[model samples]
Target: MFKSKLFDSIGFIRTTFLIAFFILIFLASITYRHIKELDKISYSIMNTYEVSLELNQLISYIKDAETGHRGYVITNDSIYLEPFIDARENINKSFQSLSSRIDLDTVKQKQLSRIYDLVDKRFYYFKNNFSSKTEFNNDFRNGRIVMDALRKEVNKMLRNENKLLSSKDRLYRYNNSNTPLIIFSTFLISILTLGYGYMRVIKNYKDLMNQNIRLKIFDESSKQAEILGKYGSWVYSIENKTFDYSDNKFRLMGCEPQSFLPNSDNLLDNIHPDDREIIINAFKDIEIAETFPLLRYRIIKKDTLEIRHFKTAAKFFTDRLGNKNMIGTTQDITEDFNKTQLIKLRNKELEQNNKELTEFNHVASHDLQEPLRKIQTFISRIEDKEKENLAETTKAYFEKIQEASNRMRILIDDLLQYSRTNRSEKKFELTDLNTIANNAISELSESIKEKNAQITFKKLHEVNGIPFQLEQLFINIISNSLKYSKPEIPAVIAITSTKTKAYEKPKLKDNSKREYIKITFKDNGLGFEQKYAKKIFLLFNRLYGKNEFPGTGVGLAICKKIVENHKGYIFAKGKPNEGAIFEIYLPV
Candidate 1:
């Protein structure tokens, strides 16, 4: 748009300048005839033969000044201002011409000197800083005043001859009357148009510069990100059949950037011998399918002689010119691939270990318990058959043996339950907590009755979890509370559930975008010291002696394991003699 406007302005200026030139030409010709007639008429009246010619020459210089001023106004060009300067210089020529007449020219010299001084006065205003419209207007008005002064000076030079000259000069004067004002109006319009265009150009240039800077910054930032992330990008032009690689792309191939030009052959050379066909098919696929599907392949590093993993994804792009290009990124995933393989090996080892542990669990549950049962059976037989003959100490030792066997049986049972919790085949089903809690209460009905415990629950939330494991969780926690209940006070276990977000509970540790069912079991039991809250959940971790609390020290550990299986968390909060709260958070 700026270029078009500039061309239009140049064209307008050319037309105006040409029109001014012709107008000046037409005025000059008329003025020339008028001067010729005045010269003849004056010679007959006075002996001033060179007077008319000198005066006509002066008129031509004035015409040059007008044309210069008009051009300067129309074009707003410094080049046009040169004519004003030229007029100033050429006025001296007019003075010199009128001076060397060698006729009785004392009066002419005085009058000519006054004209020269008036010309100087005319240019004085212009010579000052005159770029603005107001300055131009003032200079133009001064020019008209000087023109009048100069004409008056000319008339005074030959008073009697002027009467004949004035009659002929009137036609020339009338012809050029409105030229200066018309030219000045064109000058103002031209200045306004040019100023507006210049401002728009500056504004556009600034906007373009800002966009370019942002693009360059983005390019640099993307390059840095690729380097830090161990990735590289490449572009393939279908029209040119050429390959262009980012700097990091060359580095990934174990060479300095641009050390080797990227082409299909060179790219294939970097690929592992076993995986080279995969890359060959990738390049072929761009044209065959017009798309490159995801490809995970291996490349052999030239420097390290080690295989590195690479995965590429690309899409076909047609630019504004309809040139097809395939742009893709390949990342160095050696670390991630190796870690994944290591995890698979570790998982296999764990599976084998779990199988052995399951076998051990069977042995502990039955094989080991068989011998213990027999020992208990032998003791029972001795007490029934020879009770009178046995000593009191001997009877006491037998009773102690019975208690040890019972404790051992309890230990084996608890260990077996813990092993099942560790099993990985946990199938999740949406289990209602209200039903689970009621089931736990019914199962422990005898214990609840004996302990005179109150197990109250309401508004228990539901969650997707293993039904059997969740049941075991509720049973173990309730049993634990009953076992620790204060002797003087009836046990009060209140189970309640509320909906909550993960971040709301910092103890959950994982601030994911998930909703959790916070099932809290608050019990008025003989709670332990707050310091042992975390320690109480470990395997065989007992806060009190076996006589104080008859437990295998493994029930809470099993509860933690079961909660973890359901992708949940449990925390134990306690106060000495006050109460204990077991918080179980399962994802909803």
Candidate 2:
């Protein structure tokens, strides 16, 4: 956010400076024009004064000629004639100068023409009267009249010149007074604009400084996370064709950070020889590919010279400047890879051991049960035919042998069943619990009757399962209840079913939203302590000794295995001397 705002502020400052620059240019242009106007007005004022001065000079020369002529007319002096003769040439020169000055002004030029005519008539009197005595008095009177007329005309021209001079002076004063304020206002506006731009720049600079500090802290934290996680990140910029390796990236190669530049060749040098071609081919399409697929290979650490497994994956994205880049992380998976291989090897060995054990059990079961059957057959014949001759003590020993043989036969049969249950290749079919429960009850009908036990159930749920296994599960659970029943009270077993969600039963500890058919078996038998609920389902985990309980401890274990085979869960709950409950959940 700060970076974006900073860019906006920079653009604003540039625009402000641009506006200020144009204002400066405008101010210069206006000031220069104002100066030119003022200069023109000043020149006009000077010309007005010069024209007035020339008119006054012309009058002075005519007056000098009149004064000298008067002196010569009374005393007849030749020096007076010299003054009169010089005044004529001086008056003509003054008239020429005044006409040139007022030529562009029509009104002023007409007035100057009248003054020139008056002067010419006065000069004609001076020459005409000097040659005739009778007309000399009249000529002198006429010359004096012309001289007075010339003075009046010259004074009129002077008044007009003075009026023009006053007009030009007022205009010059007005322009001179306004120019300074106009220029000053423009300069001040430019200064204020620059000041605002400077303040904005300062504020953005401080914001950028704070943001930079935060970014540096974030970068450091990311580096630490990479190092601790045994992973390293790298970036490939397609536009620049450049690579950037994080500090941990170099460390992953067992080299110090930035020990060498990041590039394809340097990275490939650390890869195992057999995997080098794979890594090389993967990168060859990096420029055109949108992403890098997950790749696992082996690399030789530079410092340790040890081969370690590594896996890398990356996705391609375009930066704000439209530069294509791919960022990927490479992890040191040597420990995980070795553990995975070990598990695979152990799994193979365990599978082989189980197979051999199953074959042996198959062979040994037939051999062992045959001998036990033969022993039972021989013992029964002895007991039947030689009972009368046998001593009571001998009969008691024979009974003990018979009991031992029966227990051994049951144990051997249970072991074989367990081995078959452990095989994963058993075929599954849609099986109904109602039918399985009825079949199991019928099979154990003799024992149920002997214990006066009631095996009751409603319509149970159907499931995809191994049919024989389900029947076996029911038979074992019912027999267990019958065996553990209190001698005072008849055993009562209830099988019930309901549909429920997995999360509804906390003991199931599953969070799936799928529905399950829960089948519960409640028995009013000598249930063990609640603490031993989970232990009862483990193989060979019997609560009572063999002398007290006739069970081989494999019944509930087989039940648990069958439930698991159908992707179901089995849980047991018990209360001492009260009853036990087994709940099984199977997917619908």
Candidate 3:
């Protein structure tokens, strides 16, 4: 009874196997047809690539020949002419190669024949023109026209070849859809033949489920990270060779999700106009090195025109298909950039405040001297009349008080003038320095005569500055020169102006446009050492003591402030006992 049952099961199994085998054979026939179609398409594609390669070579040869021709013409060099001949010969060879590869399609064959005829005609014409000395003009122009026509024909053929290549690519892609179906059917038939196939199928199903779950988790984590960090991730598609950005990335770019396309142009358009070329060059560098580096740039928002700073770290990823994908994170660093700018602004503000305070101290001290001087003079007048009536020690004390008051008054006045030097809120007007200088000299005419000082001036320029301030500047400088003159020598002051824009500090103004001017003041007096060049521009900074030269040491400091307020700079150069030169650069 058991043998009979086993025979019966074996017979049934054989019948089932026969039916499955027949079905497989039927499917195999259909798969074979699909595969044959794919092979034909692939062959067509290969032929197209061959034609394209040859045509491209031909185009390159022609360009080389043209370049060589121009070079030889420019230099009249026989060496360059040899290259031109070589390139021309290679052009013919490349055309022959293309011809052998391309099939006899009516449109392509016609275009190819026309190209051959034109090439031959141009070659003959160019060869004849090579030795012709008859003022090569109109004939050479005709040759160019013929060559251009030939190039156009070749281009047309290339386009046709590209179309064919595209067609083959599409066919192959469509045929590929049947491959997976055929493979799955074969797998199914094999599984049906194996009795333990169900166990394998269940295992594969479980593995697929786990893989999908992991993929989902990864995606969720990436999205969460992007949102929290205000960063966006991007991937490049190998098939399309295009960039794809995540939704978060679109948001970060200040663009709609649908509008965001990962491309060089789109990204560059968002960059600050000034920084666009810089960012583009950086991207090219990465592409050439096949490396990814962190890039920072400013992006101008499209709608709002608000600028935002962004930082990105990018690297190229090659997929299994050997296609490049650029993956990176984009982050907004606008706040950080703004904070840096704000800190710089605050530092500048603090510096300005400190300068203002110094000026105020000088002015306040100087102004107080007037009242103090009045007090001292009145006390002296009263004490002078009663001096003999008092004790000898008392009279000496009164004389001492008078001397102290006089010194104090001088100190206060000097401080006051120094503080007010460049702090006045007066508008600048066009003032001629020559006129101003003469007027300043006239005001000090008595002093100049008394000291027997000689002041000379070069033709001064018309500059935009306050007249009063300029007058004061000249007065202080001239007074210093007279006070520090070499003993027994007449004070000689030489003022000259040079046309210069060198080192002119740009003015901070609402308008973008402005002009500039330059002037210099040179004096022959008791000059100090070069080491004190910058130190001289400080309050109470005197190179000599009161006994050597009487000054509150505020003149140069006031000069520096005035020059700076005029959006100019002042620098002094001198040697001990030599003359001093002060150069001022101003933006008008």
Candidate 4:
């Protein structure tokens, strides 16, 4: 539709140009005719004015000569005859000038000739006066009659010239009036044509710019796709025996783009010696095979001299002309391949480290515990035996030693337990959480009773987990609530469990499509600030000094490790003086 509209608009513009061309031609012709008519009228008007002026001068000169002749005849004065001589000199010149001017009109020319004859006859009468006064008067009267005839002839010529001037003036006025309209019409047409052409040019420029922008966007999208996928495309024509590789393909091979045409030989030359055989065999079998699975190999980069991995997949297709061809995609998987290798190496290292740690734990457990236990026993004995005999300062020092010894023992024990979590065999079993909670409470009975703690729980769902670890997890959490209970307020810890999908719990950070048991432990205890929630789970990380709250700080860390062993997560939410909650998620 757009294309059709564009063509239609172009057609309209062309038609408009053709029409404007004819308009200009017509305007030009009309203007030429108007100018020609104006020129002719101007010429006629000039001739009429010239003829009128010359006829008036001739009449004046004739009247002057007649007056002077009359004065000379009356007084016979030579001064009076001066006017006659001057008039004679100028009259002939005026007559010649008038005749030349009015020559274009034959009627005017004849009138002018008659006027000249009458003037000449009047001058002859002035020059040759009759001897008698009567003859002179009679001759003067005849000259007056001739003068009247000359006046009528001059008036006739003037009238004829006036008519010509009026007619030419009308023509000139008509042409002058039309000239403005013609010029305005031409200007309007020219403006419209120029405006239309300018609009077309602007429209074409905008369209070209828009098309350029779209092409650039498409180019950017293509380049982004190549970069994101770490892959490039290629085609091999079997008939022509030519290979075509994409720009990114050359870049992936650590070579500058467009350096050279890609061929099977150059490609194989870059392949590692060990993988070259595999690639060669794969291509050799392509003619017989319809398709193949992904082929992976390694190459030594020319620029960096680094070994890199590449993978490709190809399929055979027949062109419309019945020529066989292969189209394929090659990906630079070096980063991913290197990451996998690094992970394998890390896992091996971790395994070896874990083994060595387990051995150290076993040795330390035996070697350190016996000595620590003996020291605690010896301190207790000394505290009892020398309690009354020692001075107050000595007794205070003994208490310090005893406290240090006790703390040392607890540290060694907790350290041993924390290590065992990673070293122990993961023996998973289906066990009731309620049973686990009851066993944990039973083990912490002394602390619960001392704190007057109210531990509440209902029958919880059974889940797949290590039974001993789950029990230990509950025991540590319950013990924490009992130990940290605010003074003068009875401790209250509520245990609850609900079945839910893993994704439903936002804090789990597990997106697996599996069900889980969300077991929560809420307590009304002297909870630490929420900021220390994660820190508390780290081994030996304590929020308070030993004088304020005596602990190894390894209980929560052990709980975290145990939960991890069961493929679960445990996190805490706490607010000072408000309360604390520990949420545990175990896959069901």
Report the C-alpha lDDT of model 2 over 1-588, residue by residue, as the tens digit: 756777888899999999999999989898788878777877876777788787788888888888888778777777888777898889888878877877898988888888888988887776523656758888888988998888788888778777877787787777578768878998998999999998998887787788888889999998889988889999988776667889998898889998888776566888999998878878887777675778999999899999999999887888988889988899989899999999999999999998888888777876788888999899889889997797999989988998999899898888778777776477888889999999999999999999998888998888878889889888888888888888898889999999999888877788878788898889988888989989999998899998887878889898888888888998888998899998888887
Q: Which has the higher TM-score value, candidate number 1 or candidate number 2?
A: 2
Alpha-carbon TM-score of each model against the true structure? 0.60, 0.77, 0.42, 0.50
Give lDDT tens digits, candidate 4, residues 72-99: 8788888889888999899878877877
Best by lDDT: 2
Give candidate 4 regions above 4 Å deviation.
1-232, 237-267, 300-308, 321-323, 334-366, 373-403, 446-454, 485-492, 500-516, 522-538, 541-549, 564-581, 585-588
Q: What clash count goes with each model?
A: 1, 0, 3, 0
Candidate 1: tens digits of C-alpha lDDT, residues 1-588: 855765576566556556555655665665666667656655544435466666766767776877777787678787887877787678778677667763365655676777778767765655434687877787878878887887777666656346545664575458546645645555555555556656656665676688689889998998999999999999988877778999898888788898877776567887889988887777775676897879999998888888999989888898878899989898999899999999999999998888888867766676777787888788789878987787999878878888998899898788878887775477889999999998888999999999999999987888999988899999999999999989999999999999999888777777776899999999998888889999988999998899988999999999999988888889999998988999999989
| Tens-digit lDDT track of model 3 for 313-342 | 877788767877778788987888789899
Better of 2 and 4 by lDDT: 2
Predicted structure 4: lDDT:
0.84
When summed lDDT is taken over every stretch of 10 residues in candidate 3, the lowest stretch is 502-511
Error of 4 at 210 (Å): 17
Query: How much is the lDDT of residue 22 in candidate 1?
Result: 63
> Largest TM-score belongs to which candidate?
2
